[model samples]
Target: MKNNPHHPYHPIIYVRGFAATQSEIEAAVADPYMGFNIGSTKTRLAWTGQVKRFHFESPLVRLMGEHGYRDVFVDGNDLVAGDFADQPIPYQSIIVYRYYDEASNDFGSGETPPIEHFARGLNKLILRLQDKVCANKRNNVSPEDFRVHLVAHSMGGLVCRAFLQNKGLGTEKARAAVDKLFTYATPHNGIDMRIVRNVPGWLSFGDANNFNRERMANYLDLPKGDDVSIVKHFPPERVFNLIGTNSRDYSVLRGASSWAAGDASDGLVRIENATTHGPGADGRDVTSPRAFVHRSHSGHYGIVNSEEGYQNLTRFLFGKLRIDGILDIDNITFPAELDKYHEENRAVRASYQIESAVSVRKYPWQITRREIRENSAIFRTYDQLFPGQPGTKRPPDRSMSPHLFSVFLDPEKSCKASKSVSLLCDLKLLTPDYEVDGVLFLKRHYEGGVIYQRQILVEAIPDTNAAGGWRIKYGDQENNPGKATLVAESRPLGDGDPASGLVFSIPIQQKSRPGLHGALRVEVRPWS
Candidate 1:
């Protein structure tokens, strides 16, 4: 009578991050939820040195409260360990893969097992969960319909990837059961320190070598010289990478970890290495959907325990619409003085930075943010953008265009019960200083100068009866605040199915010299 295996509200398996030391592992084993239940009560104001009491009831509690998801533990015993072969649990359950229990002295030999071992355990756990879930008589869920979403943090993401990618580590049935994956501050490219570059493969203390790229390659079944972020076995689009950009709040090891990890990190995982990319349907590498939040790696302000992280997680898991932004450049114009220098063939070079902050209409926090101040803005060199111009013979690479952000939106969460969803994108194209004849050309240069900056407000009205099933309108927020007046023409992608959604192009051009000429391509698609 009940929808047991809901379409989007699938069972969530929480895979906790790495525990560095023996004590840490013991502590991890002691916790029932493995840090997933941990919440925060205070937040620091970024602009002002003030602390605010913002109670975040953690992702675990929030899921149980907002959604009807229940934990597997019943009567002080996990359902997996109990005699529940015939007993059926709710389809929307939260299962914690307690892999660290094998390493804890209280449970096993007090010796940590390899990641492959954890991955194999996950496979077995999924099969067991499938058996139990399918046993429900009232629920109409078949073995093929039984799916689970993996919500992991830090190194746990790698474990999920291993279970999906490494054929020997998991069964095909278990791999197929995995519907979607959401990772928080995961170092898909392996952890790298400021001084050490990459974590040494020989550093086996507390299994630190697990973060090493070579070690990861072996366990993840990645070929030599391959990017560790590439996922070959699974659909990368279904994976959402939540990247943390605040490093100052990560006080792990008395701030030593943040120091070693350096800037542009979430105290532990570097921003550039946190997300992942994989081969697209056309055999080209495509980056997974990802967002940036100002949260630490793990602490009171950790990514997993924050509101921003939970919002993104819930939307990605149950959202109705997915929107992606990409900046496609047509051409860039230089000042007359710089053009004259280029005409002389004296070697002119300039690099640009693109900054963006994305947020929902009523949400206070930005879903994704990249700025020059945070050192997370998209950067491209003059040669990379305008190749074959002055110094090189190769043409401009359109593939080099920067992806701004990919955000999932739930139509149910539309502001004030409105039928449309409003997304605000504050974008900035910063100007680059020039170099003539390998010398600094600072004749009229100024620091922190932006060539083009505007806040673009996009309002998407989804109508089933519409031509493309959606009506999109956008406006420059700088000129017309809090409004989207310009109707966006629907350009359907791929087969032009309404489910595939449509693409809207917003022209971005600066008529003045030393400016940018580009189009902000917004792709809207139906997401489950």
Candidate 2:
């Protein structure tokens, strides 16, 4: 069947993560789907501390059941190996990139190959899939139109990046065939430990040097000073990073890995290192779309097996609408005593924290969450926000402002009765404690205080006649629960093209001495 323009369902290639031990490699080679079929039976409710009976039937099964996607393996035989007389496969099919099979003793040589070999293997696999998929003339898919989505976990993301970024590793045709890339708990910036810092290049046990930044720079073909997360060859906007924040649940090494990786990690990959960046339309390096879930790195409670991960994966692969949230700060007020202390020219240091929790209306779980308690809140220093003018009341630089969350909404997945997409952003700006001359100023300080907090609910009602193609309405859920009474018309940003999207600004202010004045700027655009 021909793919829909609005909701294109392309073939998905699952790339499994790293397997350090020989036994792990053998186990990975044993599984037909390479752990992509692992599912979870229970989930912890955020609002209530109850263990819910939510069953996520794995990404493989869910994709097959929900979207009518099929697997390449049929009747215990691999179709990619020419098992069924060159039978044509459906366009919406799942193919597991079993790169580790070559490293296993049961399948091939016992020696593990480098990441470049895996990239080359991925290139060959894409070409083979292209041949198999295009063989079906009834599907009407040409070689130029054939595309595939890369869904990976952990170190697998690096392999995909190697194929796309390293020109010498793969052909341009294979790179062009990638439609979108989604990663789960990938250490894009390289792994860091409490004592070890960056994994040393000399650490060759189980080829642990693969997580080293120096090795990554070599495989990813990144420049000396450039970050490994920067996507030079591929369209970075099409990539989605799904970060996990629950380090406590990661049982790797009997929880030793989590302790060493610290609290701001997903038990393995640090939160700050889990995202990717690429050049935006304005030529500035912008962060790709990412979401944070309260899951572990890999295990029974791993990111790949969670519902939050699957939901984000399906939406990014097939969703039609995209929304980006950013906070534009006009001014951050200080306490009266701190204001006097700041005017005295004594060194006063203060840093602000911005916490955001996003979810669709009627959903029980948050799509993206960054909270102070979770240790994943966005932090900014006083000088960083207001460069060269620390104590001044000047507005923060717009470029330095925090990008809260990027969410993709599928209109087809919306409530059948309402038929509208509703997004709720629970934003909070925590008040910072002041320190004068390296001394703590706790005169009137209270623990767990916020300068600004609100629940802004936005509803996008589809309208063909509307200027921006949607009727927008907003409401402060904290003040009026479950109501969207205020009308917010969409205004064009830049040239007003559908790709440029429409901007909707919601004014936010506290007006108190220690307050926050800003606008939560939301940009909505049509996404494929």
**Cα lDDT tens digits for candidate 1, 1-528:** 134448889989999999989999998989999999999897547546676667899999999999989998876878865686655687888999999998999999999999999999999999998888878765579887788899999999999999999999999999998989999999999999988888899998888888898889888899855368888789899999999888999998999999998889999999988988899788878789999888899998899999989989999999999889888887777789988888777788888988999989776788889987777899998788767756335455788888998989888878665488889999888889788888988887779888888889988987778767888889987789988899877777767676678898988878898777878899998887
Q: What's model 2's TM-score? A: 0.95
Q: For model 1, what is the alpha-carbon lDDT of residue 7?
A: 85
lDDT of 1 at 288: 95
| Error of model 2, residue 6, in angstroms | 9.2
- Where does candidate 2 stray beyond 4 Å? 1-7, 43-51, 390-393, 415-418
How accurate locally is residue 368 in candidate 2, as Cα lDDT from 0 to 100? 90
Task: Write model 2 residue lDDT over 296-412, tens digit each, in one string.
Answer: 998888999988898899889999888888998887877888888778767888888899999887767888999888899999877777776545565578898899989999898
What is the Å distance of residue 106 in model 2 from its true position? 0.6
TM-score of each: 0.95, 0.95
